[model samples]
Target chain A: MSVKLTDDVGAALVAAIVARSPYRRALTPMIGEITRIALANNQIRAALADVAIRSNFEATRTLGRRDLGPQRATLMSFLEYVYFASPAFLASVGEGPKEGSHNGH
Target chain B: MAIEADHCDVAIVGTGAGGGIIAHRLAKAGLKVVSLEQGGRLPDDYFSETAPPGAKLDFGIGPSTVWPADPHDSLFVHPLFADGAHGATPRPADGFRHFQILKLNGLQNLWNGVSVRFCEADFAGWPFGYDHLADDYSQVERLITVCGTKEGIAELPDGEFIPPKPLRPADTMIVNAVKSLREPFSHAIPNRKAIITTPGLANSCISTGICTSGCPVGAVYKFSARLLPEIAGLDNYELRTNAKVTRVLREPGAETVSGVEYIDTKTGERRRLEARFVVLAAGAIETPRILFNSADDADPAGLANRTDRVGQGLQDNPKSVLSTSLLKLWGHKRTYDIGYGDLLILMSRGKLPDGSDFPFIGHAIHGLPDVPHYLSGFAGFPPAVKIRMARMMFHSYVTLGLFCAGEARPENRIRPGSTTDSDGVPQVTIDFTTPPAAREQMASMLKWGRKILRKASATKIYESIDNNGTGIHYAGTTAISDDPSAGVVDRDLRCHGLDNLYVCDGGVIPNLPDKHLTLSIMALSNRLGRHLEERVQSETKVAA
Candidate 1:
C-alpha cells in the first residue's frame, strides 16, 4: 500500500531515521528515494511540518542557546550540518537527485 | 563527470590567495580554467575553528585556561613548502632560525588575516610603478572586506577600506598616547585586516578572539570562503584537489608551454593535463621548486630556469614580539579582551631614533590567558602577586613585531634535495641567512620598540625567544624584473622566454617588504589575470 506522506511526516521520518541510526551516510539516500517516491506520486504533498524541528534549525543557526550551555553549541552545529543540506532535505522529501537516487555522501 | 577536456584555457598551480584570485578572474571571463591544488578539500567540520584540537576551553579550574595548541604538522591546507626535505642549515640565532613550509591549507588555513599594502619607497627598485598595483590593491581590498583607515603616510600607502574596527580600551590609550607625543614616534592606525566585523548573518564575526585558531564563522577572509564558492560553481572552472603538478610540458624547440604533468596524491596515478597557459601560484618556495623539478632532458635546469635563476634569491621578513601594558591609559574604566585578533592589529612603520626606517611591524592586541608567560615577565613580584600582576597587566596588552625586509641574495636559495615525499616529488631545501643589515635593524627595531613602550606606557615586557611566527611571508625565489638576468620572470610575471608560462605568488616578489604578503600577492595575481585576458583576446583577434 502506498502511504500518503505530508512534510510533517516526512521530516519526522527523516529526524527519526537520522537520530535512531547513527549512519546517515548509509541510509539518507534510501530515505531520499522513499521521500522522492512518496512526493512524486502526490502521496506526500501535505503543507504541515514538525513545527518544533523546523524552528530548531532556524533558532540554532542564529545560535539562540536558550541557556543549554556548550551542548547547545554542539546542537547548533548538528542543525547547521543539516541546514547546508536543506536541498537534500527537499530532495529526500521531494525528488531524488537527477544524477543519482541517493543524495547522502 | 570528471573534467574531460584535453586542454583548458588556463591551468593554475596551487589555490592560495594568488591562485584563487587569478582563477576567479580568468574563469569569470568565460575561459575554461583548471586549478591544480596539492591538497584535498578539508571536510566541513574541519572549518570549525572551535572544535577540539582546533580550539580549547578552560575556566582555570581544571584545564586552567590553556592556549590553543599550535597547528603542529597541520601544514597549510594548501602550501608552497617542499615536502620530505631536511633543514640543511642550522639557525642558532633567536631571530633567524628555520625556513619552514606549511602544506594542506596553504598559508590561508593558519593565516591571521593581516593585510597591508606597500607604499612609495617600498617599491623603489621595481620595474613597474605603484600606479600599476594601486587599483588592483583597492579592488582586492574591497573583495576581501579589509577594515582599516587609509592614511596620508607616503611609505605606508592606504587604499579603499571598510570602516575601521572600533578600538579596544588599550588601543584607545595607545592611540591617544601616540597622538600626544611631540614628534609622534609612531601612528596607531587601525589594522588592515581581512576580517568581516559586520557581514550578512551567515558569515559575521562574533569577535571570539581566537582567530588564529582559524575563523570558524567564515568572518576571517580565507581564500576558500572568499574566492572558492564563486569560482567552484562556475561552469568554466574546475578545481582538481589531490593533484600535484609535477612539471610543465613544452615540446622540443617550442616557444610556449603546451601543458602540464601532475600526480594524483591519493591514488598514486600519473596524469597529464593540457592548457594554453600555465600559471604557477604554488607559493614562494614551491613555485621555484616546481620550476626546478620541471627540468626536461633537453632543459635539465627546469622549465623556466633557462636563466639559471629559477630558484634563486629566497627571502623572508624577520619578526620579533614585545608585550606591553596600556595600564597608564587604563584608569578606572572596565575593559574586556574579547576583540577578534585579525580585526584589531595596529601597524607602525619601524623607525629608529636616527630617522632611518626598517620594515613595518603590525601588532595585535589579544585577550590571551597565559599566566606562565606573564609570570616570567613580571618576575620581580612574589608568586601570588605575580599572578595578580600578570592578570592585571595582561588585561591591557599589545604584542608587536617588525617587518625587516631581508635581501634576496642568490646565496639564499632553494635547490632540489635528495629526499622525496611519498609522491616521489623530490624535496627542496632553502638556504637563507638573516642579512647583517637586517639583523642590525631587528636589534635596533626591538630596542626602539622597548624604548617606545616604556615611554608610551608599558610595565613588564616579553619577547619571542625564537623565530616562531616569522618568514611565512616568504618570497622572491622567482623575482620579477625588466632584466632577465636578475629575475626568473618579467614585469608582467611571464617567464622570460616562454609566452604562456607564468609565475604569480610570493615567487614573483623580487624584494621582501614589511607588509602582509597576501594583499600584494592578490593584487599582483589580479593584475596578471587581467593582463593575460587582454593578451589572449588580442591573440585571438590576430588569429581570427
Candidate 2:
C-alpha cells in the first residue's frame, strides 16, 4: 500500500479505476454478472475468496469453458472490476468507505 | 572581495499568478520594482511558432500539467512533480503523502480558466473575514476581467463578470438535469472563468477550443501576459528573465532581509542585488526552500522559522475525475471544442455515512471534445470491437473533476533537498498526509462525483480509483496567522520575525477550499502592494 510516485504499474492500475469514469460504469453490470455466476457455481465463488484477484482475472480466460454464460470479454471485465474496485483499499487508508463521502467539495 | 549589489526600492521573486499581480500593483503605484524570474520569458509570438505547451518547455521549466494542456503530455501529472529531472530532489521522508511543485511562468493559462471565490465559511481559520476579502476580490475581478453569470450561491459567491461562456449542448443537458433534481442535488451553473468574451482591456476568447495548451492568440488571461505590457511601460519597473534566485540574504546581526542573491542563468554569473524590501513569491514550495537554505550562523534553523512552521501545512484540493456522456447531447451527436469556462460548477455539503458532515466539495465540469481518432486504430482492440469503439467516440463525454477542501495537517509539507539544483540552489522534496478531516473529504468527492454523473444521464462513468490532486490549487506552508506559534507569516502576510521580508502567494493562505486559488492569490498580492506602498511613503517622509 506504500505506493511511490514512480511505480508506473500501480499508478496506472489505480488511475484506470478512479479517473476513468466509464470504468465504474464497467462495475455495476459486471457485479450483477458476478452475482449471477456466483449463485450457480460453488467453485468460482470459493476462488474469489481464496485465489488472489489478479490470479482470478488470468483464470477468467479458462472460465469461458464453464457452463456459466457471458462472453469471455464480459467475464474479463468482471474480473478487472473486482480487482481494481475492491473495498480492501480503504484498509490502507485506515478507514472504511464513509457513507455520503461523495458530497460536493 | 566584495560582491556587487544593485539596489532597488522593492524586489520581487517569481512571476506566476502571485508575483505577477504584485508587480502589476506596485509598479502602477510608481515605486521602483525589480522582478526576477527563473524561466525565460516567452515572446508574445511564442505560441504562434511553437505549440502553446511546448514553446517554453523547449527552452525552460516544463510542467508535467495541472490539466489536459497538450496532446503529447495529455494526462495531468499525478502529483504535479512527475517531470522533474534536473537535480530533482528525492522523495521526502514521508513520501507516501501528497505534494508537488508546478512553478512554470504563465502556466496559469493552462488552467481551466476558472475564477472562483472562497465563501465566508471557507475562511474559518483565517485571521480576517470574508467581508475584508470581498473588496479585494472585486478589485482582482476587474483587473483580470473575469466573465460569468451570477447564480447567488452563498458558498460560491457572485463576482464581477463580462457574461460567462454560454453552455454547450452537453452542458445544457447537465443543467437541465440539475433543475429536475431534488433540493440541492448539488446545483449546476456556469463557472466564473477568467476567459473574456467581449474585448476591452484584453483580447476576447475566440473559442478556438485548444486553450489548455496556452492560447495562441491573446484571449486566456495569464497574469504574465495581462500585466507585462503595462508593467513594461512603467519607467520605474524592470523584469529580468532567466535570473534564478538562490537565497534571501540577512546580515549577520540584523533581523530583516538585506537583499537577494541570484545567478544569471545565461551568463552563469553569481550576483547580489540588495533592496529595502524583498517578497518571496516563488510559490509555497520554493519560497520555503529559499528560507530553509538561508541557514547561516546568524539563523541556523532557517529564516523566520522560530515557530518551526516555515514549510508546514502544505495543501491542495483532494481531487477526483469521472467521465460520462450527456443524455441529449449524445442523441444530437454534436461536436464540442471545450473552448469556454467550466461548463458547470457543482457546490454542496453532504452528511457523511459516519454520522458527521463531510468536508465541502466543489466540481468544475468541462466538456470533453471528440475522442482522438487515433485511438480507433489501436491494434489491441478486437477487430469486431473497433467498429463499436469508433461509434462510441461520437458520445459527448464530459469529465466532472472534483476538488475537495481539506484541513491542513503538520505532516503535509515540502522541504529543501540534500543536494542543489541546476542553479546551485537546493531542490525540494514533498510529503503530505491527509488528516482524518481531509480523508473524509477524499471519500466525499468520489461518492458525490459518481452520483452527480449518474443522475445527469451519464454513461460509461469511470470513477478514478487513485487519481487525486491533478489540480494545482495548492495553499498553506507559510500560512498566515495573528499568532506566530500558529503559523509562519503574520496577518499582513509578513514573515513573523523578519521585518523587511514578506510572502505573497498561495503559501500565505491559511485555509483553502476546492475553490480555484489564482484569483485569490492575485487579490492578496494586490493588498500586499497597497501595504508596501504605505510603508514606503512613510519611510520617505522620515528620510525627508
Best by lDDT: 1
Docking band of candidate 2: incorrect
**Worst ten in a row by lDDT for model 1 chain A:** A96-105
Which residue runs of candidate 2 sit more than 4 Å off their true CA positions? A1-105, B1-5, B52-73, B77-82, B87-106, B199-202, B335-338, B359-361, B364-381, B384-388, B465-469
- DockQ, all candidates in order: 0.01, 0.02
Cα deviation at B471, candidate 1, in Å, is 2.8
lDDT per residue for candidate 1 within B1-544, as digits (tens), equals 1255667989999888788889889888988998888777765555452231111311111111212212121222222233233222222344233343333346676577788888766676689878879999988988888877867866678877777556666666556555665444366677778877674567776555545555666777876787878877787888888888878888865778888898887898989989999999988877877787778776887877778887788787776666766567432223342446433444455555578765456565544332123333443444346434543454466665555676778888878766666677776766666666666667766775676577667876765422232557778889899888888888899998888999999878888877767889999999999999999999999999
Tens-digit lDDT track of model 2 for B60-155: 113222111232234343223323443234433435333333333535645656778888877888898788888888998898888878887787
Winning candidate number (DockQ): 2
The lDDT of each candidate is 0.63, 0.62
